[model samples]
Target chain A: MRQNIITRFVLISLAAGLLSACSPVRDIRFRAHYHDANDLLYAAAQESDLPYLKAHLKDGGIVLFSESWDVDMQKEIVTGDGQHFDFNRRFVRDGEMVVSVDSVVIFETNKMPKNNDQSRISSLSVLGGLNTALGIYCLAVPKACFGSCPTFYLDGDQEFHYARAEGFSNAIAPGLEYTDIDALNIYTTTGGTFPLTMKNEAYETHNVRSLKLLAVPREEDQRVYHTQDDKFYLARQRVELTSARSGNDDVTYLLNKDDQTEYFSLADPDNLRSTEEVFLQFDNPGNIQQLGLVAGFRQSLMTTYLLYNAFDHMGNLYGDLLATVSIAEDDAPTIADVLYEQLGGISAYLRNSHKNEWVYQGTWYETGPIAINHQLMLLDAAHPEEEIHIKLEMNRGMWRLDYLHLTEIIEKVVPLEIQAERVYANKKHDEDLLQIMLDGDAYLVSQPGDTYRFEFELPAIHDDYELFLSATGFYMVWGREEWQKEKDLYSLYMMRHHPGRYLKKHAQAYKEYEKVMEEAFWGSRVKHQIISGHDK
Target chain B: MINKQVLLVLLMLLLAVSCSVPRGLPAPEELPYETKGTAFYVKLHDGSVYRGELIAAENDALYVLPAENQHPNMKRQSGVVQIPWDAVDNYRVYYAHGKSLVWFVPVYTIVTFSHGWFAFLTMPFNLIATLTAHFTSQHEHVLRKKDIAPEELGLFARFPQGIPTDVALQDII
Candidate 1:
């Protein structure tokens, strides 16, 4: 009975299996979450929230963001593993639900432009606008510029240019010299109108109070010329080396280039006849040596004036004349002699008449506002106790003291004998101090009839240096009631673009430049650029 | 006669065939981004940035160069450039493996037809689009697998720096 029962059960089990196998199957599907991958991409586009979108993508997704501007994924797939997807291509399906990105084909087309050369990139959409010039600079800095750029103290010369590149860590080019006029890597801006600036190549700190757009270059790997002119109270001048030795010794300078021998002067009988060279002098006392120019004459003029810097399309600075008047050939100071030494000996009056009714001579001079306009300040990464450079700019109708500068030390102080590791404070990869450099300085010039106000928002006295404002205005202007309440606003940009640890002697010239430009543009619209220390 | 036994047998055969594929299509399961088309980034012998979209990436062996090929000071940033196979550091490319375009059809297309050849033809397009968008270059992203990741930079790499110091603002904290 047991055998019969076992046998019967086995037969029944076998029959059941065959029966189930022959039956038709209904459709079945697995549970899945709705994933609109496009939503993440769209979110990234809308908010520019790269990190969020990046979270969803894996493997090569990050690489795509750096790929061609034209993003597509339809016709075929060229993966990283040397494989190609052609028309009528066949692929096999595995039984696994897990998926992956095998590879990518980085096409050599339609990439985001790495440089913004306005001349070449007439197409505006992704171009870095002039608006971001300050904001981009803020990358290295924590704050935006306020009334003026702070005094950017430095360890070297001013009037230099440096190259910057995006996504590429090395923005600075390898070539120390600028090449390729077509690529055009250098740029400049004009402030007043006369003197054109030829930025020096030396490395130094700069106080960028104000900058006029000069030229936008096309190449990323090009050399830049550093400058020493205070971006604030800019005194624009041009340097043309007609004959480097013409105005220095027994040589004469003429207003019109066609008639080189037609200059007339009143300083000495031999002033025009004995010029050996013509040196260009600026009220802003920054280094002139590193500018990579042939020999020329230079000096500091006692007065303030107006001038703007303009470079050629190729980023070249040439001295241009604003106006000129004829004088006796022998009356002007010889070009060889320093300006301050012979300015007094040189008499000035209109060619037609004699009273103090005067026009500026075509000589190289720093020109800004009679009253100051901006105050920028910068600090050194090595030292803060020493005064470096003082620069200012002329704006509207007045001059603004750009800044008083001091060295910046990242570590503040280091033990003298200790072979200690260098401490780096400002560490943002995208940061370029040039993009958002700032400093501090005082301005005495206010727009006509209280349209504007001026005061020192920072302190400059370390008691180690004796800084004087006698030249700017011996008469102390009021609003003392406003001072204590706003210690951060009433300060001045003392020095900029120089070493701070040196004696106060270097800052003396910047102090005087402030005084003269104040008198030059007493009532123009010029105002000092002051960057509030407030960082948001 | 053809009662429950036949039904059971039929159901077993159908289920076995259906279970052959769970995900339906074969693809790279791990990649965040997929290639719709192939293109190249051209870094001229002279330092400049250039790129293209519908380019190819095959065995043409005409224009293939690494990224660190163009800059004199490549150590600082070290860029990548593409050059012609024959030309040393500057040239164009013609690849055997090429890129494809992604065509976009709206969701409204589904309502236009729900049956017949109209829906049938549209059905193929939808299938193709669904697959195409799945692996397109535009939709790809990075997925970190290794403990050590390669350094990545943002868009600022394209700009050059050249401002003079006198007027160059110096801000350090």
Candidate 2:
């Protein structure tokens, strides 16, 4: 249904554009002419020419006398009983005088032209009206538009879901800049060089300090995973779930594979912070010392909506709000901390049969709605005969879990950091950008439509390696003109100081924009042309 | 099933186009000439131009209530000026009546930003459209002397029957 509406809108806009281009304004000209003074006098004497004569006589510079006046065409003389004036229309004297017709340099008149330029007038009126309406619409609902930092894409990946990672989403200011690592999930590669395309597909400026790959070596069946604390782990011997149930519904099929079919639940309408749990039972790997529960998950639109709502509330004061966040004291909780506390991450627990209780392991979370991030939570040691039962608890409707499994941890490993050797901006090699990425001293500033390809030389052409993207940068969001009218400092303060209350109050408002926001967001994506000679 | 954004855009488009075309001026004969005063830009044979309201006209001369505030030289005199038919040149009568359409500049500029990266194209198009409309409307209203005759212009004056001889020139001025 949404697709149909979008198609219709496109068609209508195209038709309007084509019509405007084809239609030209009609021309209308109102002109008059005379061969000489005698012809003008003869034409002026006729009754049929009375309208033009009257018009000219009224304001067409045909001098009028307070007394009667007569023109003798045969004698070529004009007599008038009135005040005489010079050539500049200055009064000379009030007297009866006779003037020669030969002294009359010219006799002229005018007519109001009929306006046949209706097409141009109508076109302009329509265009102006449309522009004003759109402007007002933008002023009413600014949040329906989408904006974010630089988005990275792999070769051959199609649509929004396939986006590899978003750089420094939380860092809205320079003071909060930090490095972000995302697992590329590209376990195998045949080429010697790894090419990654980074695009600034938002109305924002990106100041990227560095871009590199974290390659971790693993065997055929082993996979590398990162924890919430940024620790890397190599896990092997995967064990699929024997059963998975969320509120009595078996969802094992949804969580068994990393096929992008995610399992999710709706948020509690009354309270957005309400939590839910899913129970999973996996076969116990006998005598396994280190067991890790790997889960592939991504955030739902709840976070996106909340973040965008906060920005909307800031409005024209967004710069002031961001400044406060950036210059916050060390002991004070920043915006990130406040948001994280409001929407808690996913917590896992192991069911202990001996103690007859569920023991909390750890919570893991990564921001972004595009990429499904997989993190491994180390589970406590369990008895071999006992079934490995795990409970995954998280904020309702805040997360979408795509995959879950139990794996035996081999050992902790540090990834090989690979720096880009060459950088191509818009299909042309850029040495300055490459040097900026390598030196890490300055930033490679990118505007709204910039596209850069980073090529990294791999250590070896082996297929037994996993690649992860480590990007460090910060971005500044462009303030919309519509937002300037909505500036409310008190609301911004409420959002920063009391997020829970803010979220509760804004729930209904967010609900109004949430339904179509995702579609609009993706639909407004910046079109990036594919650069040849890039590896997938 | 239509998206809210799409619906809003369509509604605005409809509203805009519906109100786009302004009402045309009344026909020449239908005009209320009794209370309507006619102003004109009169050019002399010596190239001096004067703008004022029409007072009266005779066979060989025209009586004009010169706009003293507009012309510095006319500021010294406060009464009507009479020009001989021999010293007269062409003149244009002012009749255009409408509000200034320059408000569209800011409106269109604001709307341009909503087009995302496509703003590059929309900005220039909006500016050109707005400027053209403004200048065109101004040009469409003024009646040029070459296109009209002085005899017909009397119908658009304050007294279509011709200025009353009993009225004082000072009262008319």
Candidate 3:
């Protein structure tokens, strides 16, 4: 009796497994839930309770509550591994919104393991060989394996794409068939647009049924680290360099002998004057505080200049003096000059005369490694997740770019040991405290409307050292209330980028730019001084 | 009588058909909302508020009968008020209306015909929904704020008062 009961239990289990193999969840409507409440939404959708539905969905939380545009899925699946679905057309209106996918394909092709009959024959003896033959027969013979393959055809086309399903922990019973959807590996490519198109690369045109649209709420924990702490943010990004504008004559990307990728210079080096722009596209381009560019090549006296402009996915530009970089024309050592001056030697005269000869007149061996950096606060305090588009315009692009580095803007404190004579604090007015900074860490503790001032005295400004500021609070120009953030402030005090000289000579233009920027956007603050000798 | 193998095959087919039936949106009566004479509190995007009794809600406009106690400032339109859908952000009703058991009979019948095999297997649970008009009741108001999320703030804008400090501030100094 016990044996009979065990046999009956096994038979029941087999019947249940066979039925589940063909079960399908059809036309499942994807309902968007607030990210905070998403933990409970999948369970609530299964019930018919009106109160739960209204609380979780119909209010401000769900995407359907707002107006939405319709998008249809691509009907035919491509037979190769590189087929792309076009979703950029539908998402052109609102590129910032989150995407919601409605349908997941059910019927899919199975990927079976390859068999080598010769290798298997040596391992199998009498009983093992018989078992292997029976297994092969069940898998190869369509009728023997039952209904678990990708042969389902609906309305002439296949019911779903052909791909192997992912294996879960539970084991399948004997004689039952299963399909894996993961082998299809469908993905959406945004191409700088919302609702990125889905690409399926499996070898077959799978059938598509229905799809719907919804928007997901912005995730609560989304954040980027500020580069102030010198934290490494560039390691997370994947870089792809291409021509700014689409054309056959644009920049060419090449892989060298060491497997390093770099942009190859044009065949005619003077072709750098052409209007072709080199574009650097970085993934997850949000909250980028500083972009560092280093060019490694063999140019000496020829200073190559690059102009970079930033835009968003929707083609909106950002920043006035966002960032600019240039390679210096000459790289010289001071010890050689000093030794030549003492000895009054031939090398000393050659160093003084020939240093700038190649820069103005031009020579062959003027190529070497040069590096420069530009810093700009790309995102406002409110919307930091905006993507950045970097357009590198080659004013003189004969050199090749090795790799570009991007850093986040977090906090780090570096003390500039400048002595100050006076430190003042005011509750109302903007004061200039450029005289007396004790070269020590200054502290500010006051109510919301209060301001503090300090001054630093230094050797006559020869522009030898770059200036940096570390502060815990920030203020808008002329005390604007709308640009106030209490207790969180960071600013970089460096020389402003002008064509020839710093902002000192171009004070009027710099002040006008500052006014426009204060009225429009915010960025790192800088102090201006008219330094001699380097003004040219 | 059918053989055991045939019986097993038939049972599997029934399961497949029952599982494939689609689940749809709930019927109107099954929704949790007040229907008639409900008082509404409407807040506009520009910080305006309206409180009155709802007379009729059309697709384009809502006709409020103007509760004498509520609208003290605005002039009424011939003893009735018409609020366009565009002007209002959203509104919340005060009370909950109870649905009757008769409203669920058609829904249950439709579900039964669609997935009769599954319905027979899960009849004990369906009994609770089919036997009552009000399966669940909630008096809470469904509220929606007309404010943009922090992620949508302008590039140069700052939150002066520091709205949500618990969430990290986006500070690009």
TM-score of the first chain of model 3: 0.19
Q: Give the per-residue lDDT of model 1 (tens digit) for A1-536.
A: 23224544754554354233222221111101113334333533543323211111122122222221221235222222222222111222212122222232111112121111221122111111321332332221111111111111112211111111001010011111111111111133121221111121111111122221222121222222211221111111222322211123322132212221122111112111122212222122133321121111111112111001000110111111101111223444211122223222221111112232333322212221111111112211122122121111111111112211111111111111111112111322212222221111221222211211111111222211111111111111112222233332111111112112211332243333323222221111212121111100
Q: TM-score for all predictions?
A: 0.17, 0.56, 0.17
* CA displacement after TM-score superposition, residue B151 of candidate 3 (Å): 37
State the lDDT of candidate 3 residue by residue for A363-419, as single tens digits: 111111111111112222222243333444332223333333333433332323333
Give stretches of model 2 more than 4 Å off.
A1-147, A518-536, B1-173
- Compute fnat per model: 0.01, 0.13, 0.02
lDDT of 3 at A112: 17
Candidate 3 chain A worst ten-residue window by lDDT: A305-314
Docking class of 2: incorrect
Poorest 10 consecutive residues by lDDT, candidate 2 chain B: B27-36
Winner on DockQ (2 vs 3): 2
RMSD (CA, Å), each prediction: 34.9, 16.3, 36.3
What DockQ do you compute for every candidate structure?
0.01, 0.08, 0.02
1 against 2, candidate with superior TM-score = 2
- Cand. 1 Cα-lDDT: 0.21
* Docking level of model 3: incorrect
